[model samples]
Target: MADISFAGQVAIVTGAGNGLGRDYALELARRGAKVVVNDLGGSGSGVGASATAAAAVVDEIRAAGGEAVANTSSVASREGGASVVNSALEAWGRVDILISNAGFLRNGRFEDLTDEQIDPILDVHLKAAFYVGQPAYRAMRANGYGRMLFTGSASAMFGHAWQTNYAAGKGAMLGLSNVIALEGSAYGIQSNVLLPTANSRLAAEMDQGFMEIPAFAQALQNADFSTSDGRVVPEFNTPLALYLVSKDCTATHGVYSSNSGRYARVRICAAEGWVAPRGATPPSIEDIASHFDQISELGDFSEPMTVYDEFTAVAKAARKQGVYP
Candidate 1:
């Protein structure tokens, strides 16, 4: 296959100061994108800020003959998100790509999760994707072309104890991206989510050593599981993210996971559940309970991509089961 390039494309990457975001910004710049490296230069806990973090990345990009500008706006507020995008608009006049990757950890168990922990995370990781993407999306819609990507996490899709706040924030981005993919489709734009596990500060500090908590540890160990920390390397996670954010990406509304060298789609599907008979009285709790196994079985399921697809699946099932007759 020929090399994929972002030549002449104007892109924005949030939290580009370090870790996976830095890797993404540098690589995108290297591949010929005019990048806006947006970083508040905050700590892993999201408690402080500096301009040097973003400036340094921009410097590296320029040193390597790539184009980049620094933006130190936080991604937790609408104004902050727009300011970051404004840097791109101010420099290049258009935005062709967006990678919503800005975030910091605020870990806590469900019981301990507080408004203080929850609000900022939701603001940064979830709402901010919309804050930035909405403006960039409008630009793409006018230009009639765009590619948007979200930096999601495995912790949300799967589970890690003491990380409800972090997980909730990351999980919501997938929902946001899915809607963007649908809405952007008619405008020649695409959106996707990336659940990447890399050896970054966030990954290392995940769950606050929750794995050592024996009950959770024993339950998470699957019988078929055979893996090591080899997958935590960040370099291995960048390729898929880059591909999905490039112009050549034809796929949209996809949730993909990349750890080490393993790359795969993470799917959400509905089982072929029991359907109530036509004209039958509303099923009672006892009746529903009796069919619990059938309702939960994944022997046959549909991965609906849109709201319409859900109805289509139901119609198809009705026809197959002779319910329409």
Candidate 2:
């Protein structure tokens, strides 16, 4: 296959100072994108901000002969979101891709999760995607081309012990991206979600001791974990992210999990189960108890393409059972 290049495209990567975001920004720039490297430079818990983190990434991009500009704006507020996009417009004239990868986590069990922990996590991971995408979306609509990617998480899909706030925030991103994909299709804009697992500061914060885990250590011992034998360190989970935001990627409203150089698509589907008989007045407790297994079965399931699909299924079932004339 031919090489995929961004060429004249402009990309905005949030939290681009380091880790996965930095990897994404550099890769996009190397592939010919003029990038906006946005980083609030705050601690992992989302307190305070600095310009150094963003500036350093931008400096590195330029030194490597790639174009980049720094923006130190929080993704948790409307003003901050607008300011980041404004920096992109001022520096590059237009935004063709938005990689909403900015996020922070405060881990706690469900019972211990506070409003303080819940609010910022949602503000940054979910709401900020909306704030930044809105303006960039408008620009894309006018130009008739755009690609958007939201950073989702495996914790949201598979559950995590001490990550109620984090999981809730990431789960909301799936809904956000799905809606954008549906709405943006007419305007030539596409949106998708990515669940990435990588060794970043956030991962380090999750458990510093995870680095020394036996499984990871074993892989390192075999040299299987090395992407570049001691010199050019590889951030393996980034390719899926870059592909999702590339112009050639026509896929929309999809979810994917990526890690350790492997990628897989994730999907949400409903189970097909029991259908009530004609004139059934909300099956009794005894009746439901008897059919519970059948009611929960997944065999012969139907995928609902829209909200109306559920209504249509109900209507059809009613007619089939002679419940409706």
Candidate 3:
């Protein structure tokens, strides 16, 4: 394969002060992208802000002979989102890619989770993507070229005991990305979700039991082993992110899991499921229970291309049963 480059392109990477976001900003800059490194420099719970975190990344990129600018704006609000993208516009004249990687964690069991805990997670993880992506997406649509990658998480897909709020927040990103993928395709804008397994501050704060699951635990430990020093560095996940948001990447409407040099696509598909004959009167509870096995069979699965596709399937089945007038 040829070398991938972002020459002449402009990108905005949120939460770039440190960890995965920092790595992504640096790599994009290294590949000739003019990057806007946006970070609020807050703790893992999304409190406080500072310029140091973003400025340091900007300095690192410049020192390495790459182009970058720092934007110390929170992505959780509409104004902050606009300001971040505005910074990119002022510096680069246009925006080509948006990597929404800003996030934080406030872990709590489902029962103990409060509205305060839930609201911030939703604001930062879910709503922030909307805020930032909206303006950038509009620009991309106008220019007829754009790439968007929203950071999701395995905790959302697979579930985590103490991260109910966080999982819900990340799950919203998946839905948001899917809609963007569908709507943006006509305009050359591709949107996808990233379920990254990096050793960021959020990972460090996770309950040990949450980390002990055999499948994920092994990956986490492997990342730990590869670090030269004892520090848990999130740079391990940058390469895949860089590729996903690059000009050469046209793959969209997809989800990917990246960590420890392992990358794979994740999909959301529904089973075809059993269908009752139309006009057959609603089935009894007993009848549904009896046909549960047929309804649950994975072999009957089909990937619906759109919301209408699902409805069309039902209509087709009804017509097939001679029930449509």
Candidate 4:
């Protein structure tokens, strides 16, 4: 296979000052993209800000003969999100790629999650996709080429305790990316979600409290997860993310996980469940209880692209079972 290149592409990476975002920005720049490194430089919990982190990344990129510019805009707000995109347009004239990776974690039990914890996370991880994506999407539509990567999380897909807010925010990325993929298809654009686990400040934050559960912690320990200068690091996620946002990517509306050097696709599939008989009366609670095991069976399944697709799958299954005869 030939080398994948981003030659002449203009890219925007949010939270590019550190962790996975920083790795993405640097690698994209190295691969010939003119990158906008936007970071509010806030702490792991989303408090405070500084411009230095972003500037330093930009400096590193330039020093390595790659092109980059720094933008210190908070992506959690409408104006701020647009400002990040505008910086790219103002500097490079177009945006061909976007990596919506800006986020922070506020860990808490579901019942104990606060307004302070919930609101900012949703603003940053979920709403920021809309704020930055719309404008960049428009540009890509006009240009007839674009790629988008939204950062999701394993916590949302699988399960994690004391991270309801974080999971909610990340889980929304799957829906957001899926719709964008369908909408952008006609315009030569594609969107995908990345559920990545790497050793970074973000992982460090998770270790502080989120990883305390023995089963969860033991699983990770057995996975041989390491930190700081270890093999399982942020740069491991960079390649997959860059690929998803590259012109060579043929997939859209896809969810993929990259964890500790393991890469795999994640899916949301529905089982071919029990269908009610064609009659005026709905099935009773007792009837449902009896057929619950059949309804829960996963041996036969369909991955639906939309709600209509889901219904279509059920219709076919019903026909096969003589319910639609």
lDDT of 4 at 21: 92
> Model 2 — TM-score against the truth?
0.87
What would the per-residue lDDT of candidate 2 be over residues 1-325, giving only the tens digit for each residue? 8889999999999999988899999999999999999999988888879999999989988999999999898888888889888987898788899999999978765676799988999999988998888888887887889999999898898765577788988999888888888889998999999988775677544733334447644644675545533322237767888989987788999999886656899878665555666575777788888879977877655566567787777676566547675
Q: Tell me the number of clashing residue pairs for each predicted model.
A: 1, 0, 0, 0
Per-residue lDDT of model 4, residues 177-202, tens digit only: 99999999999999999998876676
Residue 258 CA error for candidate 2 (Å)?
Answer: 0.6
Task: Indicate the residue-level lDDT of 181 in model 3.
Answer: 92
Model 1, 143-214: lDDT tens digits are: 999999998888899877888888888999888999999999999999999998777676555654677678
Across 195-309, the per-residue lDDT of candidate 3 in tens digits comes to: 8876667765566655645765666666545534433356656777878888778888888987556689987776656667556698888878997987777764556668888
Question: Which runs in model 2 stand beyond 4 Å of their true positions?
Answer: 207-234, 312-325
Candidate 3 colliding pairs, count: 0
Q: Where does candidate 1 stray beyond 4 Å?
A: 207-215, 219-230
Can you give the TM-score per candidate against the true fold?
Answer: 0.94, 0.87, 0.89, 0.94
As a whole number from 0 to 100, the lDDT of residue 212 in candidate 2 is 49
Each candidate's lDDT (Cα)? 0.88, 0.83, 0.85, 0.91
Model 3, C-alpha of 25: deviation from truth (Å): 0.4
**How far is 204's C-alpha from truth in model 3 (Å)?**
3.7
